[model samples]
Target: MPNPLAAVAAVMIAVSVAARALIAHRGYLAYDDFPILSMADRNDPTPDYLFRLFNNHFMPGGHLLSWLALRFGGFGYGPFLALLVAGQAAVSVAFYRLLRLMLPATWTLLVPLTVFLFTPLTLEAGTWWAVGVNVLPMQLAMVLAVGAQVKYVRTRRPLHLVTLGLSILLGLLFFEKAILAVALVFLVTACLYGDGLWSTIRRWWPSWLVLTGVSLAFLGLYSALATSSVRRPSSVAEVLTFIGQAISHTLLPGLIGGPWAWFPAGDGAPIASPPPAARWTAIVITAAFVAYTIWRRRTTASRAWLLLVFYLALVLGLLGATRMGSVYSAVAGSVPRYIADVAVVAALAIGVALCGIQEREEKAAKIRMSPILLTGLAALLLSSAFTGIRYGDEWAKKAGRDYLANARADLATLPAGTVFMDQPVPEGVVGPLSAPYNRQSEFFAPLPEGPVFVTQGRDIRVFDQAGHVVKGWIDGPANRPGPRQGCGYRITGGPVRIPLTASTAEYWHVIRIAYLSDRDASATVRLGDGEPRGFDVHRGLNAMFVVVYGGGAEVVLESGDPAAGICTDEVAVGDLVPAPAN
Candidate 1:
């Protein structure tokens, strides 16, 4: 009465969905994903809002998801990522259905689970909302497109024709970075029956036309709003390199086991780049599989096998061809993902191979019937979850929580609309993520505009009105860390004045100073001709010298007992404090 296989698939998929959704839901959005907010603020009031939106190089699905988030998120990030992860999980199930149709009863549940479990990176695509939105819809389109084609051939129904058309349309939405498998599907169909135009047209014509229509529509859409720069393939040798990378990235330690030695450091570090050996290995394996299948081609089942192989090969060859290397270069890195869909078809061949065997000893029979298969399934899920968690950790590091807590107190002090410039002030945030403040905003919407100074990364004049230097800093005083005595620092070309409209006690922007002192260096603060004051560097990033007496001075980071991570660099004085409490 109860199907063990169906139950496993249901449970595993549900668990996978919940795990990935949590990761996507937890963090603040950054970089490319955050750009959607800037675009939303575009003030572009025209029908072309959607049209112009897709023009950016990032694929489409992400854009659509973020826009939807803006409508309801009030521009927040959590719900947006949550929605994307959920969508991706649903689409993943769609691919699961496609697997069900292709695999036999025994392999049906195991194969799909094995594939996801083995591929760790899939979690990143599934969990990171930006990546999830792009990957899931495209994978769903691929599954549907293939499914529709399969149904059309079996049923010869016009409804299938319409379905295929829509699937193709969905597939065309973005370069999708995954649809390169279409060509493989085509070639697999070709190799099944010796190819010819009329025969080809009859058997695969609908798919061909549908795919073409999809291509044209997507290209038109890309042309309309795209300013994406094309990446050049560095060299022909890169072909071999990319394939190798794909192989390593795709099946390592799962399909074929390997020691943990090869794994990268910390989950956040970049993955292994494409390697050359893996590429050729893939080719050899594919050729061997096809050759064996064709040699054994006999029953109607064998003919179907040939179709899948030929279709997959044609797609690979088309994608793999290097003449216009640039066009296919990024694909080399993407090959692992491409192989995932192909592996589903390949799993069918493997199942057939196992089923075809005649006789075996009891022990041997168990290997075939259970342990090898069961162990493989368990291993796959564990690997996938591990990989997913690694990616989650990586996303968090890139998102920057530790640094934000330290910076936020200072940033919060400055009212919105205040501009405090310093080295590495991340494009929109007060400090640069690479340099200091996490760069999070899309278009830098300056809250308070004034002179910006300090230069560990970039110059300040870019955001200032007068093109003169204004240095600003935010840090706690001395070793003590908290709200009080928070040393706010800044330096500008001229004297700072409290606007009649602004409170005299509440300075819109203050000053940041670093001095060359050990015990305590007291300095002077003079607004126009106010008075000289002194302050000490709290820990670091706050070391700058301000010259209040000499035209309005500079702050030099005083070196004494070496701080944990301070490089010997000069600090500017008169750095504006958001609110100079003193």
Candidate 2:
């Protein structure tokens, strides 16, 4: 007869993958996905481009995969989605392997694996391309490394040591935080397999030394290249608030299939939005489970739970120090991606506590029926599935899909030689913080056969709110008519200054020159004592906009070419905008 437990486990794994595949299908590239793909498309496959830190993350492996996906896959969504699904499946299988090694064959073995597979807590890491690329591999490595450590402790094999070191390196290539995987292995060995902590270190010093060397080498490279400024909690109160939000609100409920409510997270994916009742119920249930496990006598349950708490503290500490100042800090814990690896570790901990690691001499026992436990497991699975489906639907409705589709279609239709005036994407796509990446040039780089983009152009257009190409103009608080009544300001070989009717403020602003030239001229324009910028004045009447720094009382224009001359009548200092309709 077929083993019922094996059949059940297989079904759960299938359901989990199918559920995530649905989410990936419904999802579109969002936020950082734009920048990741843009960077990949813009640069060639050089060590410098591949290994360089992106927004503070040193993820050469993820970048390499992205570059490969772009090279072979083009701009289609298929390659990225396939990579996400494959990575997720690898992590699930690696985790199941770890469970098999750590626990005996019993119905109890399936519970933690089930939770790890279905928890809505990992939805973001599983579905989002940019996040999944880094996070999924790290998760896979953590499980594999832990399992490798278990094998080494039992067999003391040199092969297992190499595998363990390779696993850590694999994670580091994808995410800086994977350094924590080494720490987890230490926790597992010292707490679970050791007769005493000191003895374990004495016996395992060589393995520890190797892991440390690998981590230090990676950190050395990371410190030199990472460009993001460190964000630290500003106050004790802020730290405490982050802890409460991450632990009490996010982590606890997440473990028990919760944050039962889903709300759209501004322009990004939906975040956990559990009501008060959901939060408290999660707390009661999870707390009771942990307490009962620890209170059970003669088992290594306390030690296993201790390992979990230590790892949780480590994760919390890292997040509290770095992410406490986030714009979404209030809901930082509710964000699934940050704590995705925690679910993997928690599963390992659950298995260790329930079924001690000691090998059983008896044949694998059949799963004993327990009415209460079975019902609770069923409820958890059902709750998680509902939440996952709802989150996927929310993801499908996001604006990124429509925006990318419309922009890509329209860009292909633009006339040849129509250069775009660079600007940040519509605020709905991403915020100002994304910078050079959020620039129209970078944002649209992945669109196959897109038009060229330049900072300043005489024949330039702009993407309007709906991403359609349109005539570009500059609108500013200060629009200065030429000081002269007629003929405006003329340029020969020397500088010509036109005083402004209103003073421009001290900030980055665009200046537009409306001019007519009998001949093309190479010229320089300067704002009050700021650095001079070069521009071209074409024959006949035309307008050009250039970004300038510092405030000024006038516009200064000059031609380097003695033979070339131009006339300008107006200057506008502020932002670039779509030209107003006649």
Candidate 3:
């Protein structure tokens, strides 16, 4: 007969993987996927090429995987999604292995393992391809490193130490936050084996010293070579504030569902704070747990108490080091990708506590289960799983459908070499579901002459040279209003000429200018220094459409009108295609 416990664990793992696979059909996100795919299209996956591409980036492993996805997966996201699910499954297995080492491998251990597998905090990490690629690999490496540490502690084997070191290195290669794995290994060692704090340090000085040295060396290289644009905590106040906020965000969301579970968006529904009652209750419960843990520490250094402390410390140190990057703000600390590791640690800490309680009860020759404890644990597990699945469906179904519709609409109309601005997608769209191509104007590269496209919600509009939406082309509501409704360049009274260089002269056929003026005015617009044409502008907002026949056009705003000069809001020149008449 099969061990029922083992069967349950296997079933849970299978379910988790199956759930992830079902949601993996969602299309590519714009965040890092677009840039990675673009890179893959341009460069070959050679050692030298990868080195050059990732020399300034800390995540070479992520980049390599993305390159492979593009090379082998073709344009479809199915292959990349498969890889993500596979990585997550491996992390789950590694987690189970670590838990087995820490607690008795009995049916009870399956509870925490199941909860960890379905933790709502993993939803973002598991769904988004780019996030999953970066996070899942690092998580797997961190778990393996912890497992290696456990093996080394038990067997005192040199091979285990070597494995520990290698795993740490692999984690670091995947993400800078992997350094926390080293700290966790040391903390676990001290808690499990050391006679006292100082004694543990004295014994493990050499190991920690080596790890610290490696960390410093890596930091030095990263500082010199890394070109990431993320801002670092600039002052002591910022660092402290970030640490405090990160801790709160991690603990609160992992313990109870909150606004952080929702995917952020430009026009999404507002996120409501947890009710005051619920908030205070969670705080009281957490305080009680901490107080009890501390009280227990005064009597005996039980493994559970020590493990809980170590886990908290690990969470603090990890968030402090990584969350300080500009990529993460204090408010954004609860982001699932950032806190997935914390969820794992919290699960382990809970498992260890349960194990300690059982051990104590056995020693006393009386086994008693607290209904309150069991009820609370069950509630937390059920709530987290419910929230995770609910949001996972939103991301997979609603967001996925919106993204496909937008991609198809834009791709069908927009031609190559078109320079346009991006409109933020609808709120509640979890992944990037806006425009198909890159939308960040700040980093857009020069393109050859082609048709330009502008977006307002899901609607793509063609603009004329005077910066006006082309009439008769789009027959719908004149405009779609949202938070980012009017996003474009604001040009004051000056010679604002949309530059059409030699490279972009032929591909573009028309220039669209969307503008507004305080008073009535007219400006001379020239295309590629060709014959100058005069255009009249009305008060308030106006659109000017001009055909681009040659190189590039220069718009000379005449300053004759003393009144507020024309404010050019948006300008785009590209291949303008008229929509089929309705």
Q: What is the C-alpha lDDT of each candidate?
A: 0.45, 0.80, 0.57
Candidate of highest TM-score: 2
Query: How do the residues 436-461 of candidate 3 rate in per-residue lDDT, one tens digit apiece?
Result: 33332211211122234443211235
Better of 1 and 3 by TM-score: 3
Q: Which stretches of candidate 3 lie above 4 Å from their native place?
A: 23-30, 48-57, 204-206, 213-217, 227-250, 256-263, 266-273, 287-330, 357-377, 397-582
* lDDT score, candidate 3, position 452: 47
Kindly give the number of clashing pairs for every candidate: 80, 0, 19
Q: Kindly provide the TM-score of model 2 when superposed on the true structure, using C-alpha atoms.
A: 0.90
Question: Model 1, 494: alpha-carbon shift in Å?
Answer: 18
Error of 2 at 214 (Å): 2.5
Cα RMSD of all models vs. native, in order, equals 12.6, 3.1, 10.8
Query: lDDT-based ranking, best first?
Result: 2, 3, 1
Worst 10 residues of 2 by lDDT: 360-369
Q: What local lDDT does model 1 show for residue 429?
A: 27
- What is the alpha-carbon lDDT of model 3 when measured against the actual structure? 0.57
Query: What's the CA RMSD of model 1 in angstroms?
Result: 12.6
* lDDT by residue (tens digit), candidate 2, 273-390: 7888888888888878777666652247778888889999999888887787767677776687888889888888877766656563133232333686688789888888788878
